[model samples]
Target: MSAQLLERGALRYTPAGVPALDATLQHAASVVEDGRPRQISFEIKALGIGAITQALGALALGQEAEFSGFLGQTRNGRGLLFHITHLVAHPMPANAL
Candidate 1:
């Protein structure tokens, strides 16, 4: 997904001493849902672990990027977290279809 890094917490280490980063991603796009045009905008909590944590930690807030990852339950098991595994820094602007 293409998203903007809205906010991030200080870089922290996991219990096993592995790097971890917690962030929020904001996404906005237009799509067709149920045969009708729809505008979608939302913010999601995200996590970058291992080496990816360093890269994600280096980004400035509001930076746009292409993120590839999976969704999983948050630590508290009450919310979802986008587990970012790969990303392209400053992806090209989106083209209108």
Candidate 2:
């Protein structure tokens, strides 16, 4: 029933070369039906490297970010969350500006 700081890490791209940001947010809450302890996990991603960096910076500063992620399920106790991801300023292509 208390707010818990989950996990934090730098954002990076996958094997496909797509940029992304990752995060895991954990929280403890009372069960809706059984009133037992519950845990939540949050995974976030960004489409571009710039956006992921910006978001990570914001999080480091302890600022509230608009990024999207997962919310704990009262029943299943797990869920998947997706974020639209933001681009920082103008995202330049791989070739050139």
Q: How high is the CA lDDT of each candidate model?
A: 0.90, 0.41
> Candidate 2, residues 4-76: lDDT per residue as tens digits?
2234556667777765655443333345547756655433322224445554544432223344433333224
Residue pairs in steric clash, candidate 2? none
After TM-score superposition, the amount by which residue 71's alpha carbon in candidate 2 deviates from its true location, in angstroms, is 9.0
Clash pairs for candidate 1 = none
Per-candidate count of clashing residue pairs (backbone under 3 Å): 0, 0
For lDDT, the strongest prediction is: 1
Instruction: List candidate 1 segments past 4 Å from native.
Output: 91-97
lDDT tens digits by residue: candidate 1, 8-61: 998899999999999999999999999999999999999999999878987777
Considering summed lDDT, which 10 consecutive residues are worst modelled in model 2?
84-93
- TM per model? 0.89, 0.35
